[model samples]
Target: MSLVESPLLSIRNFYKKYGDGCLFCTTDSESENPYMDGNRCLECGTVWACRNLNFDLYQGEILGIVGESGSGKSTLVKSLFFNEEPTYGEMYLASYRDGEQNVFDCSHQTKRYLQNHELGMVDQNPYHGLRMDYSSGGNIAEKLIAADYSHVGQMVERAEELLEKVEIPVARMNEPPRKFSGGMQQRVQISKALANRPPLLLLGEITTGLDLSVQARVLDLIRTIQQELKVSMIVISHDLGVIRMLTDRTLVLNQGRIVENGLTDQIMEDPQHAYTQLLVHSLL
Candidate 1:
């Protein structure tokens, strides 16, 4: 799908750090400083998970955030999903208040409303995304309920529809996620995330730990969802292969900074940054 004129979501100067900044590390400057080793501050022991992250996700576009572990790939998505608050930065959602308001400064109630209605997240771990004890259908119904679907019949039908979309058999709707395989659990998570028909979806290392065949299936499902539902997605992964297969544009992150950003094909064919070159070569 082609990107829209304006960004559906925009993040500006985003930063997330684990500790209080000391005099040696704290600075107003945005340029790379000598105070830190990689992403960690030598003086204060502060770890900057994300620093000065600026990016936009356009309508119907799949924006991939690729990095090695601890490169802030998960941190970026977690912040956007409101699981973690940014130390500093602004996030604007075009669907919310005409993209004028900073989402980080919004009231807790407003954030909850956005989570329930405007955004959906599929975690890398099924344990984090789904309730192991809940019935597969019940899980999707939970999201629908949060979206204000009060009718029991409608919720059931919607849950069934979502399950089928993810290729889960209707017969297994009553089974608990704990009883399902890892791949099946991930599929259930995908269905639940789509339950509200959210305009923006955040997938954090979703295909990690799955078998090759299962991973392909999940990737295929995501592509189908984008094509059919026209939902914009931010996919975070350490795997460049997944990013190349799924994303239209890719952001290469290193030591909490985005080192490169461009078309997925262009980035794959000719990565500029040393870290990106290593990633591309490793893929080859």
Candidate 2:
């Protein structure tokens, strides 16, 4: 499908709080701001890892979510990627049903189908995205298999093309990712994620823990791929630099809420929220 004028993904009032509601909750009525209104379970202290995470991902755009540890950035993406089931909310993907199907309500099989065909994720940990036991080519083939591509000859041809696009030497295609450096493995992960030509890609802290030089190269590769493929993306990260380098727009998360959101340059150069100001300053 071609890029649309509307957002490719829409999330409304998403919530993912662990445990039962707090003792403060006495009736069916609920506070719009449950966390601040003392709705937390008084007995167990349950809290929303992600709450009211509302946003839209336009086709062919990169949106960044930045937050500190425990700030729910991971939870938010995991929920959208269907790794974690959100408590309550509505999610729609343009590829699914003309923005009609709530992604969260799809059956397990349909969810898997959407995940395999419509969306791709390269997680912070390579293990989450790569088959450590499989050769790099084999790993890409796994994605192809999930997408129902079974022509062995074509799969090999496509896999090599992907590896080349991500700047991985085609000679290394037969080697297991374990033999590659962290940066190389990440490249392979990127290749795998893009193998299916998914409409949306989910990036989870891909540069964390890498050397600065490695991070720069990976970031460059991501920028190149997005430009070449015109894929929409949701980038999850704590580093403002990564967000600045890759995203057109960014959202700042504090205590699981969107503290601020705007163009990447605007958010960095003229932050509006106090937390966002501190976050921008921390870069210095």
Candidate 3:
């Protein structure tokens, strides 16, 4: 009954299979996994990793995803954004105009447009997301170009403004991502991701590589920008300390399954799952 609550993004009976030797695929279906060779679903049992996984993300809410390596955090989030299609069940994204639509069922063009105008993602390493060869300004400008903003000059100006907003000085705009410090590069990545003013930002361990002070600044900057823009975000991190400070709600994941989901405070103060309790305990 409690699971029936509304969520901005909801996943039901979600399933995924990776590839040959990747357990995600082998066990889900009776037929031989066609796409790849010999991969298997990790869960040969009722639920090895994720089975009947259910959760909801509310608008303007920072939903923290916490889990150890190979916990299906990345897999599940990717599915939500339509980057990776789920094997069975459904995932929906709330649209401003069209209401909620199934992510996997949506047309490629529709998903691409939503990814541009409404969604943003910052991965574990900014290097993977940022164009290393392009200047910071160019990187930021590229999004606008992709969005078909006709006024390149105006967009460049806005890019500069965004660089400043993310704490990247104007002098560094001409520099490539390789020249920036990890923190600075991550900031530039954030700037580029936010260039189109997407309504939702999906961040996966984005601040992991930065030092404490830099991480603090980036966190503050994100909070500031989100408040100013009224943007919604989903942050995935292994650090409960960071999640406790940054998120409104938290989900605990282990071995590719969600063990706990609740308000951030509740999860932090009184964890229900053993994995969550262990994770919270390990936070510094």
Candidate 4:
């Protein structure tokens, strides 16, 4: 289905569990309960990472996912990236498989191609998202390589273009990320993530560790990129401010379940769930 007619990406009844809660045995698992918290599972020494998560990301939408630590927001990102397989769920990208093929059922080769071309991720940790040892250009090149771009000059030119777009000096393309400040390192990561122009961009806590000033710049850069590229994005962050400023729609997860979902403005002004109310007030 076309993005205008259907979601660019859609997830239904998604679950990620661990230990005794493995996918095979989770048919009657308590983890499916929206109120089931980890402590409940931990008391029994199991882990229910995420439960019954359902959402839709419209084409070119910037959707925000917010929750406290251990709320499964990060787990959601991992599941989508295929870094951690879900116990059971169905995910579809209209850009691929007609939004009908179960992503989890895709073969390894197809999955790799999708990850490299259909999806891009800005990891929560710069170290995980970027190569510290590689020069800025090299880091960008790594992504290009995954997409099978082999022309050295063309890749370099594209790398410089992305760096410039992220406001990094093209001259510093040879500098290792280790020499850059935390903010600069994040910029490099953004440049690399966008190298292939993936249709869906997954952002994991992109601004958590930076100074206030740096965070503003990075968030601004993200906003600009989203507008210019018209890419749909799923942004995971605990900061309500981040969600308010960047996201058009918001999902509030609590203990692995989505407690609230609506337009960012509505959620902020009149949070429905108790947990979400507390979360919104704490930001005041």
Winning model by TM-score: 1
Global local distance difference test of model 1? 0.93
lDDT of 1 at 18: 93
The digit string of per-residue lDDT tens for model 1 on 100-151 reads 9999999889998999999999999999999899899999998999899999
> 1 or 4, which is superior by lDDT?
1
Sorted on TM-score, best first, the list reads: 1, 4, 2, 3
Kindly provide the TM-score of model 3 when superposed on the true structure, using C-alpha atoms: 0.85
1-284 per-residue lDDT for model 4 (tens digits): 64457889999999887666533434455445443344244334466668889999998999999999999999999889888888889989898868889887888788888899988999988999988998989999999999899899999999999989988898999999999988998889888889988898999999988999999999999999998999999999999999999999999998787889999999999999999999999995
| Model 2 TM | 0.93
Better of 3 and 4 by lDDT: 4
Q: After superposition, how far is residue 46 of candidate 2 from its true place, in Å?
A: 1.0
Off by over 4 Å in 3: 1-7, 20-50
TM-score of each: 0.97, 0.93, 0.85, 0.93
Task: Sum up the clashes in candidate 3.
Answer: 12
Q: How far is candidate 1 from the true structure (C-alpha RMSD, Å)?
A: 2.0
Per residue, candidate 2 scores C-alpha lDDT tens digits across 85-197 of: 88888999998889998989989899899999998999999988898988999999999999999899999999999998888889989999999999999999999989989
Give the per-residue Cα lDDT of candidate 1 at 245: 92
Top model number, lDDT:
1
